[model samples]
Target: MRFLIDFFPIALFVLAYKMADIYTATAVLMAATIVQTGLIYARDRKLQTLHKVTLLLVLVFGALTLFLQDERFIKWKPTVLYASMAIALAAALWIWKKNFLQILLGSQLNLPAPVWARLTIAWIAYFLFMAGINAYVAAYYSTEDWVNFKLWGYVFPVVFIVGQGLYIARFIKDDDDAVEKKP
Candidate 1:
């Protein structure tokens, strides 16, 4: 349910691209993203920083794609987004001496500071890799190929997320274990 909602825009864009054209797909993506964000805000009563950044980039890049009649702008959006995330994570970890991943998930999982730092660095590296891959695909491939990559390339994130979950499972304290350890 939540997964479908989160991917509504991308799915719509893919469908539109297959049925119509890149311009049409861009328009669909723009509208779908706007609606998706609106629905999220309506349900949550607030928007996260990630949601805000995604929405802003979609609007800006979508507009540029439409105005310029070039698909490159929309194609570059993912690379820009990924690069920004990588930079933000790196800055948070080094300059601010903060692990943003820990800040976001610390309440749910209690991990040591070193573990959190490693997780943060892992995410930074992942983001950088994803950004490079996206840029390479967009620059070297055709529009159709890029669209196909966008749809199929989701496998990378799915694998990364699953691997992260498995890696962190060892650190997560089960309820029974936590209770037994409590004095």
Candidate 2:
């Protein structure tokens, strides 16, 4: 349910691209994203930082793509988003001496400081890699190829998320285990 809410916009964009053209797809994506954000706000009564960033980028890039009659703006949107995330994560960890990921998820999963630091670094690297790959694909490929990559490239994030979950599983303490260990 939540997954569908999150991905329906992208799915609509892909379908629109296949059925019509890039401009049409961009319009569909813009509208779908606006709807998605509205739905999230309605349901949660608040928006997360990530959601706000995504909505802002989509609006800005989508407007540029439509106004300039150039597909490049839409193509570069993912790279910009990924780069921004990488920078934010890196800055939070290095300059601020904080792990934003830990701050967000710490309540759910109790891990040591070292583990959190490593996880944050891993995310930074992943975002950098994703940004680079998206830029390369958008620059070197045709619009059709880039569209195909955009739809299929979801695998990278899915794999990364699964791997991250598995890596952190060892550090996660069940309530029963924590209780059992209490003196």
* lDDT leader: 2
Tens-digit per-residue lDDT, 1-183, candidate 1:
777888789999999999999999999999999999999999889998889999999999999999999999999999999999999999999998888998988988999898899888889899999999999999999999999999999899889989899988898879998799999
Question: Model 2: per-residue lDDT, tens digit, 1-183?
Answer: 787888898889989999999999999999999999999999989998999999999999999999999999999999999999999999999999989999998998899999999999999999999999999999999999998898889899889999999999998878998899999
| Stretches of candidate 1 exceeding 4 Å from the true structure | none
- TM-score attained by model 1: 0.96
lDDT of 1 at 146: 97
lDDT of each: 0.93, 0.94
